[model samples]
Target: MAELPLADYARTLTGDIQTLAEAEDGSIPRTFTRWALEQLEESGFVSNMTVAYHSGHGVMVYGFGYSDDRSVLDLYTTAFSLDPMVDRLTKADVTRHYRRLLAFLQKAGSIRGNFDQPTEVHQLCEGVEKLLSNASKVRLFLFSNCESAARTQPEPTEFQGLPVEHHLWDLARLYRHQTSGAASEPIVVQFDPPINCLSVQSVEPNLSVTLAVVPGRHLAELYEEHRTRLLELNVRAFLQARSTVNRGIRLTLLNEPGRFLTYNNGITATATAAEFVEDAEGRRVGIRSLTGLQIVNGGQTTATLHHVFKRDKKDLDGVSVQMKLTLMGSDDLMAIVPSISRYSNTQNKVTLVDLSANDKFHVEFERVSRTLWAPPTTPGGPQTRWFYERARGSYAVEEAKQQTSIVARRKFKAENPAAQRFAKSDLAKFVNAWSGLPHLVSRGAQKSFAAFQANVKEQPPVIDADYCRRTIAMGILFKEVDKVAKAHDAGSHKALITAYTTARLCEETGRRIDLDRIWREQQVSDAIVQAAHDLCPLIMDMVIQEGKHVTEWAKSSKCWEEVSRIPWTVPEELAEELLARPVEFAVDTREEEEEQLSRLKQIELSEWEMLADWARETRALELAEQQIATTIAAKLATNATITAAQVRKALEVYDNAIEEGFSAFAP
Candidate 1:
């Protein structure tokens, strides 16, 4: 497929931004920043970014983030123009934005005290100061709506003795990223002195494997340069100090560096291409470079080694680790990479749901979405379908496929409008809110999807036509509530308000909010919209009154508990429209109870005793709940039969403990 011209793409992007801003009642800069960040995150360029726009005193910042291990800090800013025709960004413009971001870091201490009370800006300034204290490197990203005319980036400089790198993502670069159809920009690694390796035989024409022993120092340097990009395909984040595996690796590095190769299971990696050197006998013997390299397994080992090398200043002179590198073409990456990632980590605790984009549930849901059309709101209006993009950019791919004919493209879009398209994370957020998990939804897309995936794994819901209808209804309700929330306050805590409102509505109505009616009508009622507007302020007040960072507070389960306790009632008009949940939609309580009991019984008596003791020590549970935990532990010790009510109470206590920040596997 041919790429769109840069000028045309820019105009198209401008239209998209305008449409999004209008829908959310937000500013252009805010909408563009959010949209760009989402794209970057999906491409593995960034992760877990907190969007907090603050600008004043010759300083500006859209958001900030840090590496999972706190070794690298990221600050982002935007240079947006109102004119789509303005297509070039000068070097001076880039430097000015860089200085604005640097000024934020340099003056964070004094800027933090400028606010009388803690606000988002003040919290961000304080966070910057704290994260920088231990950071070894800082990255300043400048996102522009125009293309950069310069071909070279600014050289790396130092900030507070830490190296600072600059990255520019202009329109031309973003356009390529969107059209390239790759998950992330290809990473090209060149070896100064080529390392020796042995090629393995493979039956597939497009597949090749190489076995090599990589120096520990070289591996550490690579990790420091790429950070989490190397582990993007890995199932889990770096486990850090809490993981026993990491601890063992650390010990081996400290005491027995020479034995590291013998103790470690090594890493499995994949690449699009590998350059090899052949010996006199025409045998491939060494690797000179690798393109699009990604670590599919052994993330914990790689991260731990990097940590020890940087933080402890350990000498890796005798340390060496094994590597299995698989080479394949870009055409095979999307089809085969997930399987490689999934199978490589099978022996570990990684679940199939961790890489859930290709899961059967989502596949079935996408099938239903494509085949099932919503009833038209008007009697004679055209019926439309909700496009569920199972993968990122699938909607665009489908539209591009029909681009040979203008009429065909128009018909494709009219039947499945861009406004009605949703992605996996969107479905997770909508369903989680309706399922009484607004806290999880507020935790950000990656974590929220993880929680949602766990629930789906536990229950394994059947994705039928009825299920898809109800899911789409939840999406409609969320969008309606979001529109009302954003209209009232465009800049502050709109997501929280929308999520909490939907969850509260579900609780107050006892899960009888007439979702079927919403599905059939293809819109929310005015009464519910009004209810959302009325409830948003109260939710905001509750969230802010706690004097904590709004994002952090919303992630806490206590936030939901307190908001659920608020003395509010649904409007009478909406109350009359509520319908009892259909019998077909009801879960089998007996089966669910049995599952819960089975899971609880799997826990060891000692673990239960420890949980009870810790709960009492932390005061996480009330006296009655603490006593029940103790009773359950005792019963387990004696092999005594526990009643169904006790099992229910024990399960509640476990959940509450988790909410209180208790971790069963914390070191």
Candidate 2:
């Protein structure tokens, strides 16, 4: 699809920001910054970000955070224009913004003492001072709602002897990022001197493998440049010397540099494309460049090498590590990379749940979201569905596909409003908060998602139609309470307030908030909103009284414990309306079971056969379970009557097959 014109896109974006700001009772810049940060976090451009706007004395910042490993520090600022027609941000404007952000970093120590009463800004300055003391690199980002007129980025410089990099995300750039439908902008690495490698021809088209030895110094430099982006596909983050493997890597790097190559299980990496240099006989000998390089395995070795090089000041002169590279096309990256990551890891265990977006639970949730029509808020009004974006850009992609017809696009938007769309991380946040995990929600999206996934792995939930409706209800409730928190105080830490308030409400009300009613009405009642408002300040006071950085304090389970201990009861009127017990919307078990069985029956017989064969081959099921699957497939082939018990057993076997890496036949 062709890109939208800059002016048109800007107007649309402004409309979105306005809608969001109005909903949250916030300003344009804060809303825009929060929105952009969500996108960046989703794309792995940043992680564990905290939105805290502070501007004064020729300094300004909207957010701050560290890389997952704390090797790089990031600060964010915005150059938003109220005028929708505004098209270009000049180089002078860009420089001023960059300098303002830099000044915040430079003067954090001095300005930290200026605030007599602790504020979010003061907390941010304190965080900056502490994190910067050991940071090896810093990044300053300027997010603008206008296209940048500057053609070239500022050269990398140093702040307090640490390297500083500048990045600008102008409107045009953000537009591409939203529509590109890729995880993140590709990371292209160019080698000054081509390195030798041995290539193996693969039978599969557009797939090749190669083996190469890379110098330890070069590996460290690459990690410094890319940070966690190189490990995007890897399930686990850098353990940072806590694990025996990392400690051993550090010890070897410091004690025996030469044997590092043999001692390490060489990294397994994937690239969208690779440039090769040929020898005199026309044989591919060296690799000159790699595009979209992602390390599927050996992230610990890579991270530990960089850690020793930077923190321990160990020499990497004789250190060399082997690497296995798989080259494929860009179209195949998402489809093929996760399998490689899941199987290649030798140092750590990677579970199916860690794959997250592709897990069966999410797939089932997405399916329910597509098929279930939410009741119209008013009689004779059009019904809509809450769009569950299981993948990053699925909503945009679906919207783009309808652009060929104006009516189709209009219908699509009416049915799936932009405000109703939520991503997987958003679901994680809402559910975690309601499940009395405000501390985990406070840890930011990626970490919270990791925690949520681990919990699900331990205690899996059935993702059914009723579950989907109730999940959307929780989202609606959280958002309404978010407005209450913002109206109480529009500054930083509103997310923490909303999370704690909802969690406390659940605790105080005994999880009897009538979610079925909320789902049917498509919003929370006035009493719940009032209850949230009543709890907001109390939660805020508890958070501030902890005498810790608000972000840091909110991340502690102890904070939740203290907040839960606060004496707050639901108002009498709200309590009288609360359900005696949580309501189950699916009242007709027979009909629900019939619906499920119908869905299973809709799957082709060949697909069921394929599933059975896979389960038998992988030994994912017990012998009895395998026989059950085979029986179901045979019954389907013969149009035989299948019992409800058999159907349940078939589903269990199917789920087991999915958990065992079977995806050839997904129902």
Clashes of 2: 0
- Per residue, candidate 1 scores C-alpha lDDT tens digits across 356-385 of 456676887899878899898899999999
lDDT of 2 by residue, 441-468 (tens): 8877766676677666556666787789
Model 2 misplaced regions, further than 4 Å? 1-5, 238-245, 353-360, 378-382, 401-414, 454-462, 567-571, 582-667
Candidate 1 off by > 4 Å: 1-3, 116-119, 238-245, 331-347, 353-360, 376-382, 401-415, 457-460, 487-493, 534-538, 541-553, 556-575, 582-667
The global Cα lDDT (0 to 1) of model 2 is 0.81
By summed lDDT, the worst window of 10 consecutive residues in model 2 runs over 236-245
Give residue 190's error in model 1 in angstroms.
2.3
| lDDT on C-alpha atoms for all candidate structures | 0.79, 0.81
